[model samples]
Target: MSRRQSELEGRLDDMLSRIAMETQEIKELEQQLTDGQILANEVLQRDLEGIISGLQEYLRGLRDQARRSQQQVDSLQAENQSLQLHLEDSQRHCRQLEDRARTHTQDMSVQQEELSVLRTEAHALRDRQVESSRQQEELEVELQQLREELARQVTLGQLERGALLAAVDKEKQSTEIRECQLQATIDTLQDEKSSLQQITLRLQAQLDQTRTQYTETRDHLDQTRLQLDRFTAAMLDPQEVQSGPDDLDEDKYRYHYYNFIFQQDLAPAQTARSTKTWFDVHAITVLDWPANSPDLNPTENLWGILKRKMRGTRPNNKEELTASIKEIWASITPRQCHVASRQ
Candidate 1:
């Protein structure tokens, strides 16, 4: 029984030893697994760090591109502002030029109208001058004929005087009466010669005055044309253009011409005594014409026309006559006034 018990103890000790060895092998396997896990964790941490660094670099590049883009946008905005200002200035200048052009066009139109009127007046004046020249030539021819007639009359008078002297010697008694008659005829011829000489002097003076007036008129026309040309040239420059006083109207011109005729032509002949003498010569009941009456007025030529129209038309009353005269006067046109003034 002792030997059997000892063998059992020995087997137990061997079994226990085998179990310890197995436990140690199991612990080693666990340790090897833990080491592998640690290595894997470290490798994963490094990969994560590399990825984070790549992301940061990409973000920086994006930020730099955005900054460059912002600067470009600012520069473009400044250029756009400058371009807008230039466009505004261009528009303003264009408007000013248009205004100036419109003004110049209107001025040209007015000046052209005025020039046409002046040309018409010039043509009328030339026609009048030509008529005056023709009348003057006719007067000169009449004067030459009168001078030739005067020479023939002088020769006849000389021959008659010689015949009268021979007849006086033949009959003394009849000669006395005949000589007295011949002397009276000689005195009448002398008075006629003096009157003709006075008339010739007056005609010569009138001719000289007419020549002077024509020369002055031609000079005035030339000066007026020069002024118009200068004004037209000035119109080209906007800065030089200016408004001037308007020309006188036709009524104002007529008034001035009438005043001139009164002052230069009528005033000298209108003394109180001369006016009285004229009325006395006409056997007029009134001392003179009524104030502003057409009678004896140089500018009034309508009276003769009225007289001619009234011929054979006898009115029963003064009122009817006045009405007829007023109607006829109203019918007279501006053209008639111009014709009367020219005459």
Candidate 2:
């Protein structure tokens, strides 16, 4: 019985040992699984963090891209608005140009028609000129023949009168005293007649010369009239004539310079001796006077200023004086004219 009890105890111990070994192997396997699970959880958490970070970066990039796109869109919109405004302006300009072109074309057409009419009138005037030239040639030839005939008549009369005087001088010698008295009277009459003939000839020549001068002046006047007529015709249209108040004012000012002679006189307050000494000082004269005078006088006033400026300086010659005058004139201004005219 003691041996059987011991054998049972050993069997129980062997079974307990086998069970502990299996339990230990099970525990090791569970620990390994737990470790694997923890490792997997850690890996998953890291991956999730990585994904979140990537998503955040992508979102940030998207936001920046969106901002850039919005800015680009805004710039494009502004550009579009600018282009639209330019297009409208260009369209308005084109319309204005088109209107001006139409008006210009119409004006050109009218001008062409007027030019055709003027050409026809010119042709007619040329024909009339040819006819008038033929008539003038005939008149000139007739005038030359008349002058020649008058000259021949005067020569023939002189020859006949000389022969008669020679015959009378021989016959009247016998009739002594009576003949001498008659001869003296005849001689006095012949001298007086000769003088009268010379006076007549001179008067006729003067009359012919006067007639010729008159004809030339008349022809010149006619030519001037014709030129004025043509000019008036050519510049008849109000639209074509660009004259304005400014042009008229310019012409008025220009006319003032045509006969403007500047003179200087002595001042009223000076004594005769002193006045003579300073006759040209601080004195100005305008020689021309008209109903409508331009309100400017610096051209003449500057001469007085120039004289004042040259009071101490003596010019050597006309050349130096002219150069000095040019310098002084160049220094004058329109404002000076305005002030001078007011004074």
Question: Residue by residue across 1-343, what tens digits does model 1's lDDT show?
Answer: 3354456446555755665575566556556767777577557546755754574565456556656666777788899999999999999999999999999999999999999999999999999999999999999999999999999999999999999988877788687889999999999999999999999999999999999999999999977865654454344333434433243222222222222212212333665678758545533334333443334443456776667678857889999999888888788776766666555
Instruction: State candidate 1's TM-score.
Output: 0.23
How high is the CA lDDT of each candidate model? 0.68, 0.69
Clashing pairs in 1: none
CA lDDT, candidate 1, residue 197: 97
Q: TM-score: which candidate is best?
A: 2
Q: What lDDT tens digits, residue by residue, belong to model 2 across residues 1-343?
A: 3354456556655755665575566556556677777677567657756765675566566556656666877899999999999999999999999999999999999999999999999999999999999999999999999999989999999999999898888777756878788999999999999999999999999999999999999999977765554444334434323554223322113223334455333335532656545433423233444444543545666666667777756779999988877877788787866667676
Off by over 4 Å in 2: 1-62, 89-93, 142-343
